[model samples]
Target: MRELGAHAAALAARRPGEVRLRRVGTSRQGAPLLLLSVGHGSRQALVVAGPHANEPVGGATALRLAERALADPRLTEGADATWNLLLCLDPDGSRRNETWLTGPYTLGRYFRHFFRPGFLEQPEWLPEGAAGAVLPETRALLDLQDELRPFLQCSLHGVDVGGAFVELTRDLPGLAQRVAHSAARLGIPRELGPFDTLYWPALGPAVYRVPPPDTGDLAAAITEAAVESTWFHPRPHGTVTAIVEAPMWGVDAVEDPTRPADPDALLRPVGHTLRRDTERLAGILARVRPRLRDTPGAGRLLAPVDDYLLVGPGIADSWDPDAHVPGARALPLLDTARLTALRLAGRRLALRTAGLLHQLVTASGRDPDGVLPELDRLIDAWCADYRVGCGAYWIPVARQVEYQARVVLAAFDLAGRPTRPHPPADRPARHATPRPEPVRRD
Candidate 1:
């Protein structure tokens, strides 16, 4: 919370007209969750919430955008000309991710544990009738959205490993081309599509459906349900709603030809790639600023293009590695290894379920052994199924595993069977492994 406050304060101080720290709500821990509003005009409203904890880039990008918007007056100007930009919706999550934020070279580590709705093992996503309820952070946003009712709402997210970029929207015109053009300018490979076609295919059609009239306050209801529902569903009410999932690291330029398996060698050029991409993204935004202001009903004009372009193949080429080495697999192996470690960690947590139940039985005099076993079985099953489903894709594997772990942990906590850490295992010692010296290039 202190960290979030400090960052927010810094943002406000740096960009007075474009940034304001507004208190949205408090977390269960009573920590204040703030919304950083940038830009100051009545022409159009743009809301971007980030760091949902696991995905910090969104927060970083949002802050960067806010700062940029403040610095550049044209961004605030529109055809009829006025715009409102809200930055950073989840401060609690963002603050919790301070470790990664403060680290010097921890993008890889951060990407590995990248947090998402289901992955944090949070209690907020659990069903009210079945288990726990929504988190204060999510709830606050729901309330805020209802009150503000912005013209455009975007949740910034990024995948650590993947060749494709995804822009999720139910229906938005020209949003696809604009986003793709923006991505191209930024140098990030991207596509625009419905949420269903990429990660949440099952929820795609449903998300596209127009809400029934009685659906009072669409965005708020959808936000509430999203935070509370057991499954991922699209909210019919948001005027222009979508999630942009960018790749945290670059992907192999070549896909068809298999390459030698060398994770280190594969990632050596990522830094250069990202630097180029950042510059391109900045340029893209600059170009789009004028078009956004000039277009009448900019939100509607942007929607259709946003949907189709995001998912289409044309946008996919932006992030492709400039040069391809034929016969290389082009796999995001580093991300794969990190994701595997996370899954193992989640599995290790399951091992403690029995111990947790025993502790509960000892302390509360309630034997939940039978129920614990059943729950354990269910959790194991979920994890196994999740692993299988996500195994084919590095991004999905990490995402789904994180989600399953969160759900399992929340369920266990709600059931009053909290677990404790086990003592470290002893192992036979051998000669110490030597650290590799840094490689130098002439």
Candidate 2:
């Protein structure tokens, strides 16, 4: 986070005539949320990075975009949009992930330091449930959206490893293909299936457009998931919202477009395992939640894992290979390796469950009792075991950064297509192509 701040500060200093640097708001930790406005244009586009701290790739890419725009405005030269760059919306969380950002990039290492906010607590999912109550960071982003009312906006996002893909408000003609080609050039696979229950309305290869999740209905159930996407709220006028997701690890399964050798049999064992595990977690929760009631911040800490355990079982039942839509069929085969990775994710939720329980007990002003020692020992074992086998599937930092940058540039090009008052290409004439500008090379 310090390094990112330094780079932005230096760039703003170097090109005062072109860059205007200012704090949009302060973070939970009192860190200033910085915004860099580059170029002077009538239409404005907001590029946000570091909304999720673990996804640091976007932060670097955002900086690169700012630098590229400064060096040669062609990146945005023909877009007729001024750029508003939010350096890092969640510095508090970004700082938490910084420990793993520079080191050995391994799955275990990443998860060990992984610190995503409770989904409900994310910067993107905000200002809805609490009657516009928000973190300072979220307030700043909301403020920027209101002020600029940008014609286009993108939140840079990355993933553990799979392939490159995108999330858009709707299918833009030629944009999905353009994004797919870019990822293909880098040997990154386009995620072919419903990546999760979250996204829907798949546009084309590697593109998805999910409607805003129900804030009120979900809040009553999960109590942890974010209630709204900032982009969807206040319903901007024809403003295109987009996001890029790249994997840190390079997986051959993602690179290939083949189904599992035995599609029918592939997911069964994993489903069985996760189901059994889910049951075990549920049983444990029954025993633990009673002891944890009224503990300090324990409810907030438990909200996510509790929701995961409660909701995870039904998730497997929804996985019907035959029911896959066209783009969904393209998803990487959920083989043993991928299933194992999913298991690790479950382990993470479990670890979170135990760790939070430990905190609850330790801080309860209660005496160190029989169960507390037992919890401590179990947590230690999980941590140690994680270090040994967690980072098997890994990608180098340089490759991850390179692929992300390429995708970001491609996205900018696709989004920068001439905007008409009505976005006519969503119709049958999309193939005729929208006017495009000269592509910028990094």
Candidate 3:
């Protein structure tokens, strides 16, 4: 976070009037939330990175976009948009995941250092009317959204292992297709099916419409009010919000379009395993609950794991490989494997959360030793699956950044103009880095 801040500061100093760096607010852990604005144009494009602390690609994408905007004024000028970027939205949670940031990018290392806040604690998924619980980082983002009333709000998000995909607040007809095509051109697979946005309305290949705020039973039961984010609110005009996803570790299974002869047989065992593991973890949390009370901030720290235990079983029970949805008679092997990997990833995250909570308990001079051995065993078992098979490989950092940057740029074009946009036949379009002219700050 300090390095990011320093780089932004230096860029601001170098460009003086063109770039503006403002200390927006402080995070829950008291890290400064900085908003960096580049270029002055009629439209406002708000790009939020690190909304989910574990997804680090967005931060790199923000810097890449900044460099592009600084080098080629035409991107901003042509789109008629001022770019407002929050480089790291959740620094407190991000700091927890920093151990693997400079990466060997392996699945074992990634999960070992992973720390994702519960949905309730996330800046983007805070429950409505629970303003009292809003973190400082969320408040800053909310204020910025209201002040800007942006035409385009892109939240940069990613998956643990999968092909690249996207979710939009509303359809900008051809935008998703263009983004997918761009990813394909870059040698990145367009995620075929069964991603996080699987239930949302499909816009095109690898893209889905983000469902209405608080649409499902799970959301209603978990959150006190309708969960909302910059995507739903602050839309004085029609704002096209995009949640762009890439993978930390790309997997071939996510891109495979084949279907097994008995998809259900392939899926049932994994589903049962996930449920059994979730039940076991819940029991462990239940056992350790008494000792956890003495740990300061234990509630905040363990909320994610607790929430998972509360919701995980129900989710697993509802999973059906043969469930019918639009245009599909059976789940493809691609989606079947993707969803399995996705759910297993969630379980691993829950385990990591438990591990962190154990650390806190020990630090507070409380021994939650009864559950420590079990937690270690669970971690080892979960980490083993990801290490072998599952088609997991470390995706180059450059490839992830490039794919996300293209998505952002394409969204900018679609949102800036009223007409339906066409996917470019050429490579991901780039503006020649001409000499930048000094522009007034907004």
Candidate 4:
């Protein structure tokens, strides 16, 4: 963590005018991830950060943006000057994943082992108290937002599977068009709508409540309340809020399956798209920058609600495995099937192979001492098979499998027993019972 801070400080020193670093707060390990502020002080500013642990690109990009902002005089000189940038919100998670960043493993293998989700185990959504109640990182950010009262705030993130870029916003002016144009410029396919098609069935799609659109006192009240309690409740200010998502490693276009498979290939385009969008963002701020300077109170505030409403009764009705595209069904099922198979195989090899050796020794009754050598061989062979067949297959099936394993393991310990079913029911019952034979239509 100190290494990261030193690196950031070095970058800031290289370009002093546009870049400046301040210690926002410490992590669980007491490591500080500095916030890099670019541009001059303005009533309206843009805030962005990355690396939320599992997805490190956001942090990397935030650092890159800080570097570029420092180098470019135009960004900070004129009316378009001054925005607060929060770089690397979760340095703890970032440091946790340092092995993958500096390790010798392939990217696929690294993703499989190092991906860490949010507070609740979801990939992108931050948990209710992630890090702790009023995490220093979150606290510093809210303080800055309140003090600076920036007109726009964006949380940058990336997805591992989907190939499309999405901007999550309740109601922001020209947001959809801006995101779409930026994606097109960067050559990334995009979707501008609800946040529904983001999860798989096994993981369960959770509905998020967005604040109603309004303005003034109510908005300020909601924002203040949120900061005071760290609980999300909708407000009616209609302040411009947006979240940008770039697919980390997947197909280039959601509509086209023939695009490049390498994740690095997508980085340049994603960066370019973000760069273009940032420039447009600059334009938007420039237009409204003077107003904020002239009349700070005139600006509106927007707050995001933090509760996920589980659509329990409507799960089947609203569920669409292929909601994002036509005829593109079964991908999630296929991935889940592969994950379930690998998990079962690994567990079976571990337990069954051990039992087989024990049974052989007991039945022979010719002395259990002689069975030790054969047991070692059996264990080695079983492990080799498990690695090749299960671990290997799990690498490409999205990072969620690893997350699910962690969750299941934790549940097991909490319950004082292995929560995962032993031997995994011999391949998930082969076709899900045929949906009750269609209720005998005749």
Candidate 5:
């Protein structure tokens, strides 16, 4: 964060009047939420990076986008949008994940260093807390949304393992095509299977239509909270929120479109493995809860673990081997099994649990001999399985950053094009009622 802050400061120095850097809000842990405002175009844009703490690929993209906007007028003046970039949204969670941010990027190292916040702790979830209070980070984003009333907002995100895909708040066919072409040119495979946004309506191979704001969907059902970030943004502003994701590790199976000859037989093991892993994780947490419950911030760290333990078994029970996927030409059942195993192996939960315990033991001035090793062993087993099952190959960090930046740039065209405007009803009598701007000359 210090490094990013310094970079932003240096950019402002390079262009004194055009670039403006300001503190929008402070994080729960007291990290400054900095926003870099560049260009003076009439339209407004918000590009958020590191919204998901575990996904650091977007951090690099934010830096690149800022640098690009400073160097090229086309992205800002040409598109007629003053680009406002939030370099990192969840600094507290991002700090915990710094261990694996550097090289020697193996699956084992990645899992060992992984740290994702619980749904409640996340900045993107709505006010699910008592008294309707929100995390400072969430408040920062909401305040910005209200102040800017942007025409475009893009949230940068990435998956641990899979090909590239995108989710859009509104359908923009041109932007989707451009994003897909950029990934293809860079040799990044498009995700062709049911992955994170399985319930989302597909616009193409890698493009998905996100659920409307405040609308009940699979995500809202899971957390019992409306998404407060992209989904909560004012639709009256004609905001097109693009949630873009790239893969850290490229697995060829995720790109496979072959339907299995006997889908049920192929998917049977997935259910069995899910159940087995769920039980294993539950048992691990049960034994460690007594020792770690009182540790500082342990509740915050274990929230996701608790939710996983509660939901994992039920999902396993409901996983039907006989059911057919939406797209008949989706990933083969074997591919589904591989991704599901890696995701449900309790790898993320084990890492977060062990990390918290390590902190507690260290703060007490004692060695970590208690529950850390047990969780470490589970992570090791998960790493071995991932290599064999997923045919794991680490995509270069440069490529992931580039792919995210290209996708956002592609969406510039969508932002530039005028949408049907819906002005607020409470406008003052003296001011002229706003109407959609006529298409501006290049």
Candidate 6:
């Protein structure tokens, strides 16, 4: 973010006529979250990147978009909309991953530094605190949305492995095609990722339609702070929210939408691993609980991950194997890319859990028996395993960044285009809104 901040400021200086940089909000750690306004227009479009600290690929793209927006205002979906950019939403988390950002962006380095906010701590999770004491970063985004009610908003996100994909608040006409085209132009193939399509069904190839988030303060019984599904809830009707997920590594399997022939072969081991991870994580939590019970912000760091590792499996198991996937195709699942990515995800989760434990024990200042040393060994082992098993396909960083930017333009097109749920009865209807009149050319 320091670099991006410098760049954004520099862009404003260089393009004084087009760029205007301002501090939109402050992070939990007091880092300024910046907003770069690039065009002088009536319609508003908001774009944010780096919502998840671990997913920093979008950060680079956001910077590129900021620069491009200045040179060509139409990139902001034309001069009609005043394009706004939030360079980094999760500066706190993003700073945690910078250790690998500079170089050695190897699979090992990534998992070693991999850290995502526990579910409750995620930016999308709302009611951050008792009242206005909410997370300043999240508050900034919410306030921006309320003020702008943007015709289109996109949060740039990239994945660890598998092909690229997208998520939108609604199923818009030609939007999926545009997403496919933009990604295709970059030589990147569409992928639903390993388990993404399983969880979030697709509206079209490689375009997973995010179900509209409920309009309620998410306070599940699990924790008073937030719930698992407290996603970025779109505030205004007809406002479009989109997310494009590029990946570090990808393969053709992601797009096939095929059912694995030996379902048991892939299902059993992955299932076992999930359950084992859950049990293993629970054990660690139990052992560490008594010691770090009162550690500052422990609940914020602990509860969400604990629930994620433990509860997610039950959700998967409850689904009958006999039932067809909501969007699953009968095509033969021939590639091992998805399977490899799935396993890697578990390993990453384990590494992240171990890392938190190390933090917890050391911060507790009560491990006279050198549990921290033991944790060091455990974390080291996980790292070694992750490194050894890091055999997933890697997408070029440039490719990842470019796809992220192009998808935003596609999202704008979707927002402007007419939409209605049909052809696919499962989708809800989206009435077409009048496209904003493009600013007159000089």
TM-score of each: 0.45, 0.75, 0.84, 0.48, 0.83, 0.78
How much lDDT does each candidate structure score? 0.38, 0.63, 0.70, 0.38, 0.68, 0.65
Clashing pairs in 5: none
Q: What overall lDDT, based on C-alpha atoms, would model 2 receive against the true structure? A: 0.63
For model 1, the superposed segments whose C-alpha errors exceed 4 Å read 1-7, 14-19, 43-46, 77-87, 104-108, 111-133, 191-196, 199-238, 253-442
Residues 1-442 of candidate 2: C-alpha lDDT, one tens digit per residue = 7787888889889989888888899998899898888888878878888887778887777777787777776755556657788888889878867767777765545654566666666778753642574677777888888888877788888766445667776555566657655555555545544244233565665666756656554523342232566656535456777777776654444334344578557555445545665675566556666767777666655666666676556544434344443433243446444444443444555555555555555656664345566655755665554444443245555555666666656656666576434333233224333343332211
Model 4, TM vs. native: 0.48
Model 2 vs truth, CA RMSD: 6.9
Candidate 3 has what TM-score?
0.84
What's model 1's TM-score? 0.45
For all candidates, the clash counts are: 38, 5, 0, 5, 0, 1
- Over 4 Å off, model 3: 129-133, 215-226, 320-373, 421-442
Q: What tens digits encode model 3's per-residue C-alpha lDDT throughout 139-227?
A: 88888887888999999988776678887877776765676567656666567564365445567667767676774454343522235
Q: Tens-digit lDDT track for model 1 on 323-424?
A: 454543342323332333222222222222222222222333333334434434544553443335323223222332232222222221222223333222
Top model number, lDDT: 3
lDDT of 5 by residue, 178-282 (tens): 665676666666775444555456666577777654534433445333343445455667788888888887666666656567666645666566667768667
* RMSD (CA, angstroms), candidate 3: 7.0
Model 2 spans > 4 angstroms off: 76-78, 127-131, 197-199, 212-216, 219-227, 260-262, 282-301, 320-392, 418-442
Tens-place lDDT per residue, model 4, 262-298, is: 4333323323332333343234333333333333222
Q: What does candidate 6's lDDT look like per residue over 22-89, in tens digits? A: 98888989999898888777778888888888888777887787766766756644757778888899
What is the descending TM-score order?
Answer: 3, 5, 6, 2, 4, 1
